[model samples]
Target: MLMSPTNRLQRLADDSSANSLSHRLRARRFQLFEQLIGGLDRPLSIIDVGGTNRYWEQRGWAGRDDISITLVNLEAEPQVHANIQPTAGDATDLSEHADDSFDIAFSNSVIEHLFTVDNQAKMAREIQRVGRAYWVQTPNFWFPIEPHFLVPVWHWLPESTRVAILRRRGVGWAGRTPDADKALRVIQEHRLMRRSELAHLFPDAKIVGEKFGGLTKSWTALGGFPALDRVTA
Candidate 1:
């Protein structure tokens, strides 16, 4: 299906690679993290679920040595900087970690991949259980552009239509092939949550917006950040 002119314009404006929008959003998120961590002393312990060391490396945060990070995901022994530790763990069940095991539980673009609302809830509960604070980010369902495909409103289509499109090669944002069976399998794993769903999932956390073109592009749920009250105040 062809995108309307208005949607095309919006997609162009939201394109991550074509402009500084993604960069600006990431910087803003980092600023929020800094604010949340402001009252805390150094050598913070963080458990990053569904995250890799490359994310921290890209942020290039100052005083990296002062912060201890653990990367948790399905894969075993993820490659990371010497300063970071890697652990194999499930997002829905982190039973190995006791309550408040880490200063922060961080996840980026991970919740949507849970494939089900129940799974997302379980993961949310686990995050809340294991960490004193948490920060989780996921693309907004209402956003005109889909982050993975960079396509305008592709996710708005019916599931069957989306699967059909996925079966066909070379039919996605900017001439990318997203129709292979493997791609379809991966795509099925993602079930984007609306703002309300996010709120329900993390009732204690504040839902924050990351916007592009004056529209919310993604949502971040911040929980248990000590300075959050002061920062928002």
Candidate 2:
């Protein structure tokens, strides 16, 4: 049996070469958002679905007291900071919040886990309803390497073969879960999006591509950029 590649997330935590290129790409993506939101002079209200305060902190924005961040996740996060509010809710159904209640509805690396296109659509609609603008992102299916597994052409393989590979030597972060059944679950739970699908979800939004080694690795739908005046630094 072929051994799986080491888990990429663990490698990321250790700052391994495997994750360095991808991390740099991700950082650039965040910078793009920062520049896009630079025009706003007042405090920004942000609703982050499937996010945590730690995530904001990691982004180096948790200390920005001027920004009010509400995080909505399926699992409740411990209240670790006053500036960040944590709430438990489903991304697809955010009826508790009024329409346009937030300046931005942001999510990252989440849509693929929704397991169905309908669920993805529902989440997109809710994001639109709750926020005046939004930034939603997901991995690009056409990328040669699968972001989750860090395996080239892994996602395009047959299910049984994929399961067998996971059962033996699992690769990437999903492979780190030694249990084959759990790995199978991880494989089944994700569905990467194509450019067309992403465009369809947020029709009015500007579609930004995140490139890795000159290949489009992911895409972000930025809903509010068109309405903002280009900011001069």
Candidate 3:
């Protein structure tokens, strides 16, 4: 049987698929991340906001003694790697950690899930405060296809329309729900961001566009990296 577009897109996004576009892009992103932190001679400490043990495992960084990673999420994840520490925390307020407590604060495709601009700002602020350097990636609002829904122009439609669509059938990672309240909540949860908003949030950082098919797909806000000029240029 042929797979639906949503299923096809979701399969392409799975980290285990080595040949997937999302995996390849993520690998490239990690290479850039390594370049950003390559200059440091000592063991590196990183705090991954909304990260997972499997994410690091897939990236081949799970058990490396040269670096340690703290995975933070709403609920603590199970610890399966010696070098990875799982912690329960709120992204909007990371007061549990002191200023510049980590070498780098990393997040991927997590900022938009905050549901509001104010919450996004708070998370951005907390990220900057807790780490000397930060790397944040989010889907570009102007991208023709919404990454979550696997639907073209889905994000640009009216909220009522989006809710109605979700009510009818499953879209990407989200399953079909007959409940209007649940569908509306699902539609409102993901708020794709524009370049201007990211720039405003990280004024000191360099914004680099991740392009596909000559169009900007996502944006990464990078700060305090010595190779910023080389990478951005």
The segments of candidate 2 whose C-alpha lies over 4 angstroms from its true place after superposition are 1-19, 175-183, 226-233
Looking at model 1, residue 31 earns an lDDT score of 83
Candidate 3, poorest ten consecutive residues by summed lDDT:
224-233
**lDDT: which candidate is best?**
3
The positional error of residue 181 in candidate 1, measured at the CA in angstroms, is 6.3
Flag regions of model 1 displaced more than 4 Å.
1-20, 77-79, 170-184, 231-233
TM-score of 2: 0.86
Q: List the candidates' TM-scores in order.
A: 0.84, 0.86, 0.97
Assess each prediction's global lDDT (C-alpha) against the native.
0.78, 0.80, 0.91
Per-residue alpha-carbon lDDT of candidate 2 for residues 1-233, written as tens digits (9 for 90 to 100): 64324444445433224346655566667887888777765598999999877567767788677888999989879878777889999989999999999989999888888988999999999999998889998999998877777778888998777888887775676645567678678788788999899899998877878766788878888887544344221
Number of the candidate with higher lDDT, 1 or 2: 2
Model 3: residues with Cα > 4 Å off, grouped in runs: none
What would the per-residue lDDT of candidate 3 be over residues 1-233, giving only the tens digit for each residue? 99977778888876678988889988987888888888975699999999999889988999999999998999999999999999999999999999999989999999999889999999999999998999999999999989888888999999999888889988877899789999988888899999999999999989999988999999999998777778862
lDDT of 3: 0.91
What does the lDDT read for residue 213 in candidate 3?
A: 91
Is 2 or 3 the stronger prediction by TM-score?
3
